[model samples]
Target chain A: MEDDYYSIESILAENQKIQCTFKIDVPDMGHLDGGNERDIKALSKVQVPLWMAYILIYSDYADFTIPPPFSARVRSALNAEARSVRLSNLVGQAGLWYGFGRMIMRLLNDDVAKEMSDVLVKTFRDRLPEVIDQAQHFASVHASSADSGVGGDNATMLFREGLDGTERELFALAQDSTRRTKRWYETSERGRRS
Target chain B: MALPTPLRASVTPAELELIASEQLVEIVPLVAMERTAFISGAYGPLRPPTKCKVPIWMATNLKLKKKCRVVPPDWLNVEFLEGRLTQETSEAGFSEMPFRFAEVAKVLLDVAPDDFPNPDKIRSLLKDIREARQAKSREGLSKLDHSELSLPNLCSMEINEIRPFFIRAMGVLTDLVKEAQPQQDAP
Candidate 1:
């Protein structure tokens, strides 16, 4: 867990250096309820670092050469699609990473963002099992409540369960988010060819 | 490319069944129709007959066969498989299909009178099916331990293979919607 934490922090540091060169004010974090604001803020702040990492990683996948005319045309079409889809504003270097993370969390489960916060904290503390156990317990409790058909305060319980160990949730979120981002990038590439 | 003539009459369930059957035959292979199935309403049941089955093995087999390399399981229906040969399967996966359909549907639904139920529901249902397929895929992937050397590449290969089928499915769906469209001048 300590190693994981160190790696994550290092990634964050590298990302900050790469991405924050052209800094923009972080957008409004939006409405967070049920003690979720804390977690949201934490996740939001990490976007800066994540974007930095993305630039480095994406470069590994493809060279940053100036796109040819076809690619430029495709990029323009994608930009139009993004605008129509409301993705233009949602995507920037950092904003894109953050949006990707949020979309992953939403797809996995609504409470994922909060859970990731817990995972990051646990990773820092080097208590992987404890985090896992807590998450398991929370999942168990929520399962029971759901089975009983009692909808009582399950949101917090689920959040607690999700947040229980290490940065598993964050890692999952990042993986899915990256996948989606790649899809968008590919779509633009295709638009250029078409 | 020329669009098909607009379907003037409301499709009877019987017509829908026939269309579904024709679609199945055109898209998927000639497997015997199973006992339990759902036929589309566009082609009436008496028409050709579109048979719907859980095709679980077919989905799984596609990954192993290497015919498809990148599509997810939900997109691996018989109809989708047919479309992949001509279309670039990677670009036409189930995910992209619904996204495109939804975009078109939104426009149609918006201009459509208030009485009409949104076509978005169909897109949603398609997405649900895709997710269910993904869940099955996750279960299958779990059986293969992460420690294996070839696991990562194998998983990606499977996904790539499945992508074409999804693209084919999207093409079929687009065809269906276009076929069902009212004439441009009609009310």
Candidate 2:
């Protein structure tokens, strides 16, 4: 997500669909495909959801022109230099940076990927660490200085009334489990000894 | 294929939580539940052959009574999970998988290792993938920036190691998004 600054959600929601033609028949695989039950025949053009197209294309099922998003063009226009980290993040923020980058990387096997694989690698390699650096820097501030807005808000930020991402919830649960297990183990062991 | 909403292209923090919480196992009642009440909540008037989502404790209770066929979650089979483990290890990104896949697999292996064709192999493979993913996470954490940090080719266990960074990132992300949002009141 941070790679280029794009979220998968934004990419999936905002991106336009393109026509793709299958190289093989995609039999009725499952219900997730929005009720397209019939086999997608080879050599026939079908308008596909870009997300769906991504899967099919990767699996060697079909092909399409994967349009470089505006974020892609931003990176391309800036000569792929480190000078444009903030600029690219600004633009990539519009579309979720690394997501678009990773999506393009996923397309590396596609014909287009042949020409600019280097750009994709450099796009991430050069810029990604910096992106992480920026976040980590901010996180560091948030972690230490209580006067910082992020730091001061930490308690309320957590335990706020809303759904946290799954991992946060899970981590808390794991800690809770560990505490219980330790208590039980200590109690049982003490009982056994005494 | 894209996993359902709760699923992700990679192993996520949720997977670990789900595993820790323990996923439901399929239980076929040898005797009718007949709307029986239990501590967790109201359970079946469940009939035979129909599977009920039962906790491990309850499932064991049923087994003791010889009351039901306790079919493990679908991923219990060695054949099915071996394929998933292979994908987790090999694929650049993984398909959506159940939340507590690794933990459930562990439980099933511990409880009924006999059910699987190759429980030991599955155990070892899962461990290797986990270790490899943890290494990647050390690399990933050194470079963390976003809420959705892609644990490329990694597993959920690694997510636990880096939860603090991600949680902070998420908080920052929400704030950034709010800041970035154009005010409707402005021209």
Candidate 3:
């Protein structure tokens, strides 16, 4: 609920769509559903941006189904092996699986919100070590490849492809730090000699 | 135009190295010089063949000019690092390491490889220690709690490496906790 107005990431995450069923007749909102009708009817299901859906749900005007990305099937897949699951493919265009899940948690009741948040936290924890390992591995490869002109790991790239937005950012951060340290180690002597 | 982003959640490794350079190191000067005043503090008269303590930055500068030989820190040797590596691998929690070990070791090894015996072996040992410690840190992160994360004895570089991820993860966790709070109060 603490939406930082300046965060582009949060804005992009809010752009994801969720299915909401209107609880009552709504006037002049048919454009939302792309229907010819001038107004949305009661119990009508429509896909709305997450931001708008949150507003509708918060005001008790609509009820939203849990998105397929956070469905029981995904939960089982994550429980089986979180690192292997392709979280990048789970969410909408933003690929903000954790971000989206956190937003959704805000609209749910206590028990369901707790359960969903647990899944989000567990998935993050399970996959974080791999994220760090891959970042470090690629960093070392990059440092050495600059001299040897060798190619990067294909399997690592395949694994990296499955990272969600949050994980991607974390990977980039870890990679940048490792790269900076390696550069410092390799270049400090030369820079001084010159 | 590319506007600058907000401040980073943690200091970069380079910045940490710069800070670590303030730590004093023993150096044997090949050329004699009178006691000199530096912005940080005064360093004593540099008589030839006698070891004197000076900040790492000054030592590295003098060392680069081949005017001094750096005395590698007590723990910078192969045997000590190998022992620490074993402790790191065998322990559940992080082993006690110097707070600025990573930065200091990297700077010293890079600047004064000839000063330390078997520099390559020392480098490999240090790398092994780092890997072992990193694996331990990752295990700690996997057990991360929403309310708190207690990891003692983490070095500066390791802490900085995890800072961005930790801050964001904690933010997400706090948000989730907040979400569940309102419902608990509703009854």
Better of 1 and 3 by DockQ: 3
TM-scores of chain A across the candidates, in order, are 0.21, 0.39, 0.90
For model 2 chain A, give the 10-residue run with minimal summed lDDT: A185-194
Question: How many collisions per candidate?
Answer: 30, 12, 0
Name model 2 segments beyond 4 Å from true: A1-194, B1-22, B29-32, B46-51, B64-69, B146-148, B152-158, B165-187
In order of TM-score, best first, we have 3, 2, 1
lDDT of 1 by residue, B1-187 (tens): 2532111212222232222222221112233332334343232122113333222223223223332222222333334433432232233222223322222222222222132333345334534544443444333322322122122222222243223222222222222121222232221
lDDT tens digits by residue: candidate 2, B27-144? 7788876776766676666688777877655665565556766675665555665676676567645445554455555544554555456767777766665555444554664454
Q: CA lDDT, every prediction?
A: 0.29, 0.48, 0.81
Query: TM-score for every candidate vs. truth?
Result: 0.21, 0.36, 0.86
Q: Which stretches of candidate 3 lie over 4 Å from their true place?
A: A146-159, A188-194, B1-7, B178-180, B183-187
Candidate 2 chain B, run of 10 with poorest lDDT? B178-187
lDDT of 2 by residue, A48-117 (tens): 6556776677677877765444346655664546434343233232334333434444444434443343
Interface RMSD of each: 26.0, 14.3, 3.7
| Candidate 1 Cα deviation (angstroms), residue B133 | 4.1
